[model samples]
Target: MKILVVDDEPLARERLARMVERLDGHELVAQAANAEAALQLIEERDPDVVLLDIRMPGTDGLVAAEQIAERPNPPAVIFCTAFDEHALDAFGTSAVGYLLKPVKTEQLTQVLDKARRTNKLQRAELTDSAPAAGNGQRTYLSAKTHRGVDLIPIDNIRCLIADQKYVTVYHTEGEHLLDETLKDLEQEFAQQLVRIHRNALVAIAHIQGLERNAMGQCRVRLEGIDTAPVVSRRHTQSIRSLIQQL
Candidate 1:
């Protein structure tokens, strides 16, 4: 597990880093002296766990934890502080673990276990709640970025292409990974994207024209995309009829 240690005291940070390194499977990615630096490290490294100190010079750990929670994929927060009064407040922010310092090795181990379990549950929830395009009310794909969630409008999507187990959603900005399958995407955006291939779906608006190559196979060209998606036999007739109507 990747870990980021955040504490204002240099000795405390170094001590915590050493203790974390001694563990079997944990990797100490980086250490930060302040909450602001901690937030920056979190954004850059995306550590699985953050051992945060509650009291700092500026931007206290609680405030930083709240900001971390807002991230698309936030790391588990384990607030390690000398004060016991902030326990309730820490849990309220959905902190996975809390350690009262004068640190204990056994306590650290237990918190690490709890943090892993909590992180798993959070990821499961994200996967379950991930919005799909087909829902009438959900006309956007909530793509999780390095920073936060980006709500991509369906109109900006050019196509969806399946690569192995994952589906890549191509939009005006770029492509984002989708959790849904090609079938689900087609069902959701039935009014917009037409299935050109078994693994591909193209936007109806971008469907400029069709071309038949020397091999007598039909292909579709989009407005800005140069690569043509081949129309499968089953969808070819319907696509042709739809183009004629337009």
Candidate 2:
């Protein structure tokens, strides 16, 4: 499979490319330092797979995957990240597969083979159907809480409210405060998440609908739950867009 290696670190990309070269069936077609360059290379090279990094200077891997998958012919993606926890949910993005950092040769070969097989199966299934927006698959959240790392399923989350420095992820079990800033997580889970407010990120599937009261204050109702959350004025348009799409 022809592959494009993408990462900000020169050594990381080089090492990954060399690994790909070591594999018999795989070929390194290009290398990119950021998402923009990756996109440009995708348009130009049309490689079969992308070895992408999660974090970058601008337009992180997740955001770039969203845009690339929206394109006419997007190459399969395999996130080469340092975080092992992200591996479980990275497939929800446009990623066909994922590999942890300092990626072992054996693991790389295994994921590459899986990517090829999965790609074939996916194409066969979509052969008779129109191109869909996305599979509508929900991803789990790995957040570091007081006790330790907690796994919060996206379906259980009602909304994510951004505080001064942290984003409060509200779920049926209880609310958990995560350390990462809201904007970072927003980009990572853009498909399943919606920016309901500058300080809030609401799961699109959880949103039942918008209710406008006599006072002209509009609130968002959570699906399968009774509590209604306030929708900030700034995010009204995006909320409406999400509702219409759904």
Best by lDDT: 1
For candidate 2, the per-residue lDDT at 144 reads 41
Instruction: Tell me the lDDT of candidate 2.
Output: 0.74
Q: Total clashing residue pairs per candidate? A: 1, 0
Error of 2 at 170 (Å): 33
lDDT of 1 by residue, 31-142 (tens): 9999888889988998998999998898999998877777777787788898878776765555666788878889898878766655644432334343344442455675
Model 1 poorest 10 in a row by lDDT: 123-132
The whole-model lDDT of each prediction reads 0.78, 0.74
Model 2 lDDT tens row, 1-246: 899999999999999989899899888999999999999998899888888898889888888877777776567777888976665456555455677899899988987886776564332221322223356332555454322134466779888887798778888877787766888878867777777777777778778789987788778888755556677888788788878888
Q: Which ten residues in a row have the lowest lDDT in candidate 2?
A: 122-131
- Candidate 2: segments with Cα more than 4 A from true spot: 123-246
